[model samples]
Target: MIYAIGAVVGLIGGIKVYNKFSSGDPDTSKTAASWFGACIFLIVAATILRSFFL
Candidate 1:
């Protein structure tokens, strides 16, 4: 359940990040990259934890 929650959060976060980047100036590339990375990391971490424990 925790892992699923993490994935859902990540998915929603990633979509928001994408929208932010799309509607803003290109000068914020670094900020967008970090946010996108964080979303990916959350999903990956959740997958790893779930696989290890369940």
Candidate 2:
């Protein structure tokens, strides 16, 4: 349940980050990739931590 919640949050955050960074006519692909990667990392970390500790 906690992991699910964390994943949802991460997905929402990732979408927001992607939108925020992917705007305008610039080279935002890298920025969006990094943000999405960070979001995935957060989700995985949260799931692992919750499963092991809580």
Candidate 3:
């Protein structure tokens, strides 16, 4: 379930990044980094929580 959510978030982030890139947005790198960070945070948080609970 956690991974599924992550995948969905990643897909959304990918599309947003791709759109920014195609439109030549100057802040695209920052946006991409933030999105990537969010996804990684989610995965790490889930792992930590699962370890604590199970």
**TM-score, one value per model:** 0.55, 0.52, 0.96
Ranking by lDDT: 3, 1, 2
Across 18-41, the per-residue lDDT of candidate 2 in tens digits comes to 676667636567766775686677
lDDT of 3 by residue, 1-54 (tens): 898999999999999999999999999999999999999999999999999999
Candidate 2 RMSD computed on C-alpha atoms after optimal superposition onto the true structure: 3.7
- Judged by lDDT against the true structure, how good is candidate 1? 0.71
Q: Is candidate 1 or candidate 2 better by lDDT?
A: 1
Q: After superposition, how far is residue 8 of candidate 3 from its true place, in Å?
A: 0.4
Candidate 3's TM-score: 0.96
Worst window of 10 by summed lDDT in candidate 3 = 1-10
State how far residue 38 of model 3 sits from its true place (Å). Answer: 0.5
Top model number, TM-score: 3
Show the colliding residue pairs in model 2.
none
Which runs of model 1 end up more than 4 angstroms from their true locations? 1-26
Which pairs clash in model 1? none
